[model samples]
Target: MTNNDPKTQYNGIILLTSYLQRVFVAETIYQRVKKGHLGIRYSEAKALLDETYTILPVVEKTKQLSVAQKAQLQLITEKTLALMKGYFKQMPLSFNDKLALVGSSLYGEQMMNNGVIRLGKLFNVEVNKDFHMRTQFYEDRTKMVDFLVNSIHHNEQPDVNLVKPIETWVVDILRQKDYVLADMNKISEMIGF
Candidate 1:
């Protein structure tokens, strides 16, 4: 069957899971900024949050997704977006200002994961822990890309010297998973959590 066939909702779920993981990592970075531990600027954090909002719709389109899209959106809207709006209202962004934003972002992540789990249950597909681990590997690659982009934007040479090995490792892991999924003849086995 083709990749876009209905049975491949399993693959779609994996794609959605990966997207949520990126959002989760972005939230973590935002948390570090709020805690005075990182230098991520307010505008930068806002842009990341906005990007996440945009991606949420795409993630909500999974075929087996039974959770109300509105409910999922509401969770993030009430938590993450509200905090961002409140922070922007304040005169100066302070540590305390960031606390709400950080909390909201974290809560949003949990809500998203719960929604994914619910979707998996609806499809009788287990969301594997390996898939979760793969998300971290994907996040590592994302960080590498962000580092390269930032370096280039600052008129500095993008460092490729240390990235090759990591890239190879990530690609290998993904390929291994793809092979595992391809070999599975049953959806239950493919999604075995």
Candidate 2:
């Protein structure tokens, strides 16, 4: 969808943020391996995607992730986002530069598969081929992280039960904000600068 469309725009941001979150999770695993928490190499993370995919419900498939999955997902997403935030803090980079840097790694594939590029399209961000190659690092990155951290926070609380599919949370948030039209301007405002 075009970036001017509010529905598409907001959803795009959500998707992009979500993909970034997943990439963040994979990056965490990579760090873990670097720190000796896990012995696997960065190249092997893609295999874990199936495991994460398994945790998702059958009927809803990708969009209708359960509350537990959402929580687990959010944890990894938040942690990864924080890590990226910190990384950016240590060495300043614009969004494009950051995308290029991390996108060059193995994990970028997972971000792409999980809709990173698609989300970027929503925002009119142009990520290149080298950025695309990094998904391999992120394939299982989302799931492996959720599985590891889920045990600690799975039962703590529940996500808001929005009637629609989980993918539509951005739309839901927009709707909640009274941006009924939800076009590109509204979405851009909702996401802020």
Candidate 3:
């Protein structure tokens, strides 16, 4: 589908969210290992994080995107990259510390589910269904776009202060999953395409 198509745009938003979720999870794993939380050796953790870093560009490049793809996607690519960089810069002492500040932010249910599945495949760790359920919920794309726009415009280093609003937005969206789903269903019915 063309970039201008609404369905295509919507799907792009979904994909962007998925990408961000993966980035967050990767960073968290890296920090966890570095902090001696995971059982893996330091070398192994570093190797895994390095591999993950390399794989990310491949994931971005795998899709043959148009020049207007980022623009059409509401600058999500730039914003997400900036967010990741900011998080890495901040580098909280622990994942729980970050979670406490952000409150299960950065991904919805599907994104978390997909991330868990990916992590399980890559690390051979059992999926934590409870953790997945606790974090899973739908996010509103409009708010996401707004958060990106606001966050990217800042000149300072990315930190909990800068990202907290994003987490709050995510939490709020997750809380209204039922209403959002109902609205989506109504819109689909009305479009009837």
Candidate 4:
């Protein structure tokens, strides 16, 4: 009855899936799967991957996957994490991108149907995926943090105004957390993928 781990794991899995979708986005699921080395879950690795799943937080806990599907997804997650580790090993996430992801996750977790990030989009600057592939920087934080904010006095395009604040917010949250960056593998495993 006190099954809280699923919700936590589910959130982490959704984050990973969202990140993978960005990395492996292509014209078709087949192409995406190939690009990611079949690392992403087959069902979710579509060209039109759901961005909301990544940005939002947990409300209701996830229903259990069918036994067969669970096994398949576990293998997929292993592959996916392997690929992710390789990229992360090249150059760790920029502080800004980490903020975006944390903000997005916070926004999603509060609502049964959250859309804070959508509002943030009105003021966001795009993260350059092309630059990521070229430099292997894997720049993806701005793409995630459409979620939440405290106040927005201006009503114009923000360029990079909100960028630094987001990073600050994330650190504020992390300071309150029990874990740090070294616990990343635990976060991934908590997904139970």
Candidate 5:
């Protein structure tokens, strides 16, 4: 990442942004936590990877701008690129601790079931090897979210037909027989920037 190349840096930014979008469903806690959002898709990943990744022109646009504008842009871009880097160094809870929290806590986000985030995990491999590296935050998806999207069948929506092995989590919660966000993932604490 220290290569100082614009395109390379933009690729990093794209991967980080996509990863964060898939994981938290929002960058900072302050952003709107959309509960039913389907999340990042494979095509979206490819589009994002291919689009706005040309940092050269954008950086060039700042050349004629005031020093303050350039400084601000630089600050924002640098911070965005480094967003998940801090979490990388944190000491992960022990294996036992992680196991204990698996079923009870808001650990990590679901990737495969909720969204095309499964592709986000493998975006680098599928698209470009230069995309970006995966972080520790993506290791295990402990918590499931997005009830309406993750649900196999809806009690209200009669058209929803699902096969065996996949039960209706939404229906389970409605009948008070299971747990859900109750749409609570919509709540977010404002990020202090």
Candidate 6:
């Protein structure tokens, strides 16, 4: 019963998900789904999306959905948000706060993009997304980092205290020997979403 891969994947997925939930206030399920950063399974996505809506109180506001569909959404959102927020509370950072910080850093354009970039590199392959290519990850990372470094160089910002550390942290974690690579199903289980 060698479940290391699954376990690691699950852990990574949880880490990644926690990162996103902390970074941004997913206004809608579509926002979460379109991320493509997790490479999560549909079931996992469905579960997590459902969970997020609980605290947000916005997931239930869809305009053209059936009552049954809406009800299901409410349940999932509440349950998932509860579990994730609770499970990862002991970290130096709260999931939502970290997510908010990341969201704020990118000025809303590339939310969680830094983490995705690092994950893509650690996986040694192109992430599963149509918007950004494998090479784009490197280019984007370098451009973003270079921009930050140069900002400090010019004293334009005087310091790169915003996202550089998060980018570094992501890269370091992905490189850890015990780090897990996640798939969707396991991710769903970890969050209980």
All-Cα superposition RMSD per candidate: 14.3, 17.0, 16.7, 13.9, 14.5, 17.4
Give the distance in Å from residue 52's predicted Cα in candidate 1 to where it truly belongs: 14
Prediction 3 global C-alpha lDDT = 0.42
Better of 1 and 5 by TM-score: 1
Candidate 3 lDDT, 1-193, residue by residue in tens: 4544433333344444554554555444344333444433324323434533444344334433343443333344444544444332234334334442232234434564554455454435676776455443434432443343334334333456646655555456446545533433332222122
Candidate 4 ranges beyond 4 A from true positions: 1-6, 25-62, 89-184, 191-193
What's each prediction's TM-score? 0.31, 0.29, 0.26, 0.33, 0.25, 0.25
Worst 10 residues of 6 by lDDT: 55-64
How far does residue 103 in candidate 3 sit from its true spot (Å)?
19
Q: Across residues 61-156, which tens digit of lDDT does each residue of candidate 4 receive?
A: 224433454454455555555544433212254443454345433432332111223212322534344423432222233233432121211233
Error of 1 at 103 (Å): 29
- The order of the candidates by lDDT, greatest first, is 1, 3, 6, 4, 2, 5
| Model 5 Cα shift for residue 135 (angstroms) | 20
Worst 10 residues of 4 by lDDT: 111-120
Pairs that collide, model 1? none
| Per-residue lDDT over 53-75 for candidate 1, one digit per residue giving the tens place of the 0 to 100 score | 46444544554323453344334
Please provide, for model 2 over 1-193, each residue's C-alpha lDDT reduced to its tens digit, 9 standing for 90 to 100. 4433443433434433433433444445344322334423222322334433444333123433344644454443344333333322223433222222332222333533445465455446676765477565465433433443343234332223321222243234324333212222332333322
lDDT of 4: 0.38
- Candidate 1: stretches off by over 4 Å: 1-124, 166-193
Could you tell me the lDDT of residue 139 within candidate 6? 54
Candidate 2 all-Cα RMSD:
17.0
